[model samples]
Target: MEPDEVDFAHTDAADRKRREKATELARFAWDRAISGAELLELPDDRLRKLARAAGANPPSTRETWTVVADLLDQKSAWAAANPDHPQASPAHADEKIMWVKRPIPPWT
Candidate 1:
């Protein structure tokens, strides 16, 4: 009945779609990136450094997947909102991707 309420009602579906698409796309790219690498159980601080290069700013307390997932979420959300922009693969789509992390030391 109220204008603000009506507006919210209309946008609720779009919001859900955006979030779903964002999560889906982000996970797909992350999955691809780690598909072949050996799984290392490193501390959150060390792992976040790698995710940071990929463009996510997750806190130092999150797990590796959570860190990367946050990155993917951000990228996909951006892509979905700006559909005209390059949607190829946000993780691999940017110019800053030239960043390469140093190799992870072997587990002790």
Candidate 2:
């Protein structure tokens, strides 16, 4: 079977909206991450997953924040796209956004 590029397997409107929100949040967080902006690092991944949920082809996860900014900048032209969601609007831009980062133990 061919891939569902148009819908990507999602059909429900609610699911589509949820996915859109997730992507918006991800881009917002990505902008902040590469900009050296301070964000409220959530105490857990439960909430952080919202921002990274729609990442089908996210930047390499093996690297640390040290080189993520440089890599992301070159990988794609990710402008600080303003989100339509109220929470991500310019008014709340200063508010501490709850973002998540991978929580893998160093020892493997």
Candidate 3:
């Protein structure tokens, strides 16, 4: 669909609201990623707020899973570019992953 036609997917006011909220949350996540915060650091309440902004109930497990997956992608990219940088959480040991950006698919 053309760029303008994308709005058609959420023609209803409620649907539009939900989309906007979700987009905001995603943007916030990206901002935090840029600032060197772990995606999991985002509290559930914040995610719920984003869901509310989208005019829907707070995100479900599936949505959270998607968020985490995207975060891992970011972390991987960061690691490749900055191998010398310290991990996000050395104490946790599990937080040693880097951040990476998802490549824009040519299809877009």
Candidate 4:
């Protein structure tokens, strides 16, 4: 194995390890969110705050709300499908407030 090949192998292994760690963290977060441990009904401001705290570049306020709303809708659908499952009942399953904004027309 040449020196360059050894360096490349080390870099590849490090990158793979980082990716595995990220995947594990994501899976943990997902499980918590689905189990209702992590609240998903956060308003835009709170969402932004959380994102900033996590060192993440959050989307725009409108986009944040849209994504949360969509996730809630999916959770509700899952709950409806799995009525007997305990994790199916999300925190915002009963929320009726609209979250999506109307799209602007190109001609406007």
Q: Candidate 2: where is the Cα deviation over 4 Å?
A: 1-11, 34-41, 44-108
Cα lDDT of model 4 by residue, 1-108, tens digit:
675565542377755644444333323333434322233544567556544543455544343334444554556577689989977643342321222223468984
TM-score winner, 1 or 4: 4
* All-Cα superposition RMSD per candidate: 11.1, 11.0, 12.9, 10.0
Encode model 3's per-residue lDDT on 1-108: one tens digit a residue: 786565543367755554454555544444344322444454567556544643566655544435444654665577678877766323333322233334468974
Ranking by lDDT: 3, 1, 4, 2
Q: lDDT of all the models against the reference? A: 0.46, 0.39, 0.49, 0.45
Candidate 4: stretches off by over 4 Å: 1-43, 52-56, 90-108
In terms of lDDT, the poorest run of 10 residues in model 3 is 89-98
Q: Best TM-score goes to which candidate? A: 4
Q: How does model 1 score by TM-score?
A: 0.27
Model 1: lDDT to the true structure: 0.46
Tens-digit lDDT string for candidate 1 (1-108): 775565542377855644554344345444444321222334456445544543555433333354345665555566568878645243542432333244789999
Worst 10 residues of 2 by lDDT: 57-66
lDDT of 2 by residue, 1-108 (tens): 457466534457745554455345445555444232222334224334433553533322222222333433432333334344443333333432434344578886
